[model samples]
Target chain A: MSSSSNGNGTPILELSDVHTYYGSIHALKGISIEVHDGEIVTLLGANGAGKSTTLRSINGLNRPRQGKISFQGRDITTVAAHEIVKRGIAQSPEGRRLFPRMSVIENLEMGAFQRSDRSEIRGDMDRVFELFPRLHERRNQKAGTMSGGEQQMCAIGRALMARPKLLLLDEPSLGLAPIFVERIFDIIKQINDQGTSILLVEQNALMALDAADRGYVLETGRIVLADKAAALKTNEQVRKTYLGET
Target chain B: MAADASVPTLANRLQRPSVVGLLGVVVVGGAAALLLKNLTVAPSRFFEVTLIGLTTGCVYALVALGYTLVYGILELINFAHGDVFMLGGMFTITYSTHFFGLHHGQGPATILIVFATLVLAMLSCGLINATIEFIAYRPLRGAPRLAPLITAIGVSFIIQDIGLAWKGPNYITAPDVFPHSRVFSFHGVDYGWNKLIVVVITIPVLLGLLWLVQQTRQGKAMRATAQDKDAAAIMGINVNRTISFTFLIAGALAGAAGLCYSLYVTTVRFDQGFQLGLIAFTAAVLGGIGNLPGAVLGAVLIGLIQTWNEGLPWHMPGSDWTQSIVFSILILILVFRPEGLLGERTPEGG
Candidate 1:
């Protein structure tokens, strides 16, 4: 995962043999992944496979007990969670963790909390509205009252409000309807195409493969397979396990 | 077809009224009837009592806001908050009389000294509160809920002891500096400058607090932190600092309320904070603990209830029954609508 010859110069985010723990129980064991600039990297895994833990480690919510995580070529392994977001990496965390009582507009405002540019923040908010018009329509509505798919949009929109160079999304399509799942993947690709690198974690293997530039298969706190997205889609092992094939 | 048509009517008749709603209507209607009866009997006395209630309620509202602010963020009851208020009163007395030689009939000088004392008391209490959070509660962040609950009680006792030592277990009195001149007179009912001054000072502080919580960027952070601490942290908000700031604001509020209580009443004691703090805490719960405006409403209502029970010339239970009635209402609110008046009802027990 850390070969470092992607021709995109230095990778925007690089994790080297990171190991994280939850109390005494080991959650992530020697996991390594990378998202280069302008690329969509997907982490494909089943439940309890340490996918969310990997994102937490990168976001500094769960500091890795061992190993190094560098973002834009600076080490962030020991940085505080809030400071991590300030360093230009924002996550639409697992569970979409929107402030339930807050209105959609306020929730989005929280995403851009670290940014100081007032006019640019307004412009970015408008841009997010363009990406998800449903949010603009329900800007005054409480985030908790929205449908699951709408909340997912609000969560991603909130992260975009931070104007991050790297966006970490954990299970954005989880529990969404099939149509919504498709729309979410489309937006993920659209977001990547617009120049922010993405690291996506998902269970919908086929759609993740379709949208991602690269993919990694994780199993029980370990990355079992890593390759180009197109290659992983056709890989026999990934097909039998994560792809739900015979 | 007849049965089907009747079903809609039956459903409409049933509506949303539960036993509790019916009970609420009966209680409110009964209270209104009693109030009307008293008003007709002695309008001047009724108005006088109501004005006193409003003034006292303003002070309670300030303290209640402090409880609600801390509770909203950490879900801790902060039993020590009331004692912090007692400290505020002591600070006010020491700063006003000893430092400024403030006395009655100073006129314009009284206002300046009072304002200076208010600022000093607020600043001292705010720092004390923030320090308490840093030393006492922050370390127990990862501990169970009961751990902090007991710690709050322990902290309350420690503060009470400090107050006891500082004032030597005696009632401390402040200089009665506010003018006794009438602010208004109507139908033989007189509202004094002393009372009007309390309300005037309270309105601006209340408005300032509302603006700070609702409009400022820091206020948004406080709200976000309150609803979800982890989510707030992920949003790049310093959760620890926000909690500390919340304590600071809550303490400052307690300080302001302390000044009002001592100056208006002209007498204070070491043990008064415990009793008044419980009343304010009850008010917070009655109005919905985390909701700011609800705290104010609850405090005012309690104030009115206390005054009317004592002052009104009617078939009332009188002053001796005041505590019983307030606590009874608290019990009723807990049993029927634990969310308080304005609190949103949340699903309990998962």
Candidate 2:
């Protein structure tokens, strides 16, 4: 956490003293973190740990009651959800949230909703279909009818269609088999390799730590630990609790 | 760039015939059979029925667009929209008869006045519908699907009661401003100018709306929001505003249709929207609830069926059976082709 603020490489996104509440129950409390440009930052925690809240807060879906969220050197704390997206932030929300009744091609088209350049949109669609050939094969098929792994691929492809500088993924590996999980993680790495900074939220700590450059551990609405992924992966407490070590 | 390399595969998939192709075949085949049949029906009666049907169909399409647009975005039934359309016609009649003191066959000036009044009535209906969305529907959003639906029905009954209180269940005679004249004859068929006016006016309005949805930036935003609200919001679309705009447009179309019905038919009442709304709802479902062109096609088909049902001789169905027949056909269509004629199942994660 200390190494996150060297001024040499300014953070792409920063959240300070953030708080969020759902009705009367507090969801995220006094959470602070920084994500540098081009970094793979993973937030790992158990269920109800506020990992999703942190990501949603950035996009203004769940606005923090008190805090500052700065993205690319601009304060986005009070910005509307849709406007936040225009500023080059995109989220592949939990549960995929795909329009189940629309065609695969139509789903991808929606990804570029804010963009006006027709040619660029076409180009982005082409790029997405390339990454997931299954999506290409089923371009006319309804996304809800696809298999879990394929749907996850479509979700990722849909996010990429936005061509965002920062992509937030909430539980991309949920409800997936082991092989599909490995494949999804590989694709995530590939997407990050292509220069899109990522903020991944997952309960699958082992895999997330393996893929992330740095990691944060949250528990009961607070950040309990933050460190380099390599160090966190070997940390005694993390190993015993999250990594299933004997 | 990595994703672009797989274009050939997607192109191949897109080229395959979808459900839309099958529906086209059925519709075309049915229409051809109807045209090809040279029945012994009376020519005069057939012409009259066709004219009436076309006018009725145009009105149905106008009302159905409201259902389709609202359903396209919110997926809500908007049971109250029909009453709103009825109120629009009532308002037009009130203004033309009571306020302006306009009467039947007064000249082209009266025609111009009627048109102006009709436009104002439609605009007012649009504003009312927008207000309804803001006040009633907006609060119930994200609660549950049934909550808004129930609220819509409640609103429908409330409007109906208001109309009953205002007009007292009496049939109001709409002022006939246009001169009653048969404009021309085509192959022994007399063409009335009023019928021509309705078609000419309606065609352009429908085309304009279609263009607005397909060609304009607002149209793109609408489609985007319809497909996925969160994604649209993510892309900088204000979901609430878009939904409100949709309601306004739908309301205006229905209002204009009501005005046209009042002028063309010569009578209007509080309960007119109830029957017309049901017909339009059926048309929307028949064509595909959210598809634009589908609604128009369904309306025209319904119009034709209704006319033929009444006019065709040699043991054809009675007028009394029209509602039952239309609904029965609707059920069949749903059972066999749930997506409607031109509609497709929307994709997930749009």
Candidate 3:
């Protein structure tokens, strides 16, 4: 909620000259970006534009082969995926990877796997319930049985159970109805406003630009443009190329 | 790991409930007739064989549970589980008599010595099971199914070799430590304290395992990890650790079975693991792989069948045909009802 005291505006997450590979194929090529504290930053791209790979690298699922990824002024480029989550970064991964056979309450409990505080964990469960009451209503139902929107809510709620300082959401609007997309975007903004820094990757450029404070455009493993959200919204190339405007 | 069994054709048609319903009636009727005949012809012998079969069946059920637990999570039929059980039995003999200085007629002190041996054997076997998972199976987690499945067989032989080396390829006698006195007599048939002890050990282990899976946090993680490893990882659950923990628990169960078998059966051999392990695996599949209670039920059924085949006086097949009979049951179960007696028939596993 407050600006940096140093006045230099140090980012909470910084990636400098990062490169990642899937075996021999280079997936991320020297991608560099900074996410400042208390701001919703988004990555906009088309298919195979390395947007998901970028998030994966930041979360330590795909380790960078070169350069560094620092989170809160510490190099975490090669940290294990589970350890990264423990260090205060939680991801609602692509496709809303909810544990299908597990109950809604059980899925949320899994999010707080590394945490041991009984009272605080219970309190966060209450907060998640407050944010998504549908989940609370269906707490005992298996997650796979829920509708798509409800499953997405459970996925996000599962992440929030970790009480992370930074949340990385990948394509939260994918495969959702228009109404649900709007609701998901609202939840994203609400989560950010509650003191968590967010870095989102989305293909829905119009919605992402509207919600994000700053947006980065990636094309085939490279960032083609980095601009403030308002500027990116009105840019001629972005409007034509991504927004389906001729 | 579910195979695409989409094309149902004729085989699936034969499995339709309408047809199976008729088959069920005939089978039930025949079984009822057999039971009535056995009861009327030799009532005392019938009671004795049934009691013996149940005791043997419960012990086998313990081993079947180990197989089911690992398969439930990993979908890998750990051929090595049987060897682990064998080694666990070996450890019981070595730890109790050699390490703990246990002897015959030690009075009430026998309980403390037996408890100490059981714990030591369980702890060692649990570590061995975890180590096997870590070293042999963890690396092949993402490989094609056949690779890990073959690896399991190879690991099985390796563990068997270790057992062979330790016990020197012979039938080693388990010390006759269980009290020989009968608990009760029924129609001149005595049920001994030794059989009671096996039940005493097995029931608690099964209960403890059920509580662990149904109630504990770790058990929840295991279910999640089994359902989806990648999703579990994203949720910050250490997928590898959960898997290893599963092996540890399965190993402990095998240890209990080892102790039970050696005491109740009165013998342990280096090669006993494979023969008995096969029976337990059959039991797991009969109950339905990945289902816990199904495994015990399957084991009990198999045990009863084996004892009846060998122990029946009228028209009884000798002990030599026991293997053939058990294998026949396995094939019949696999063909007629592959999902097993207790296994839920999921659409994807068609």
Please write out the lDDT profile of model 1 over residues B1-350, one tens digit for every residue: 00123333323443678786798789889989999999999999999999999899999999999999999999999999999999999999998999999989987988899999999999999999999999999999989999998988899889989989988888978988887778899778889888887788788999999999999999999998988887899899999999999999999999999899889999888888888999999999999889999999999999999899999999988989998888988998877667788886543100
Q: Can you list the residue pairs that collide in candidate 1?
A: none
Docking level for model 3: acceptable
- Evaluated with TM-score, which candidate comes out highest? 1
Docking class of 2: acceptable
What is the per-residue lDDT of model 1 for residues A1-246, given as tens digits with 9 covering 90 to 100?
222224277888999999999777799999888889888889998899999999999988889999999998999999999998899999998889898888999999999998889889999999999999999999999897888899999999999999898999999999999999999988888888788888999988888888888999999999999999889999999898878999
Give candidate 3 regions above 4 Å deviation: A1-8, B1-29, B186-188, B316-318, B332-338, B344-350
A151, model 3: CA deviation in Å? 0.9
Q: What is the lDDT of candidate 1?
A: 0.89
Chain B alone, TM-score of each model? 0.93, 0.87, 0.93
- For residue A132, model 2's alpha carbon misses the true position, in angstroms, by 7.1
Which 10 consecutive positions of candidate 2 chain B have the poorest summed lDDT?
B1-10
User: What RMSD does model 2 have?
Assistant: 6.8
Model-by-model lDDT, in order? 0.89, 0.82, 0.85
What's the distance in Å from true for residue B200, model 1?
Answer: 1.3
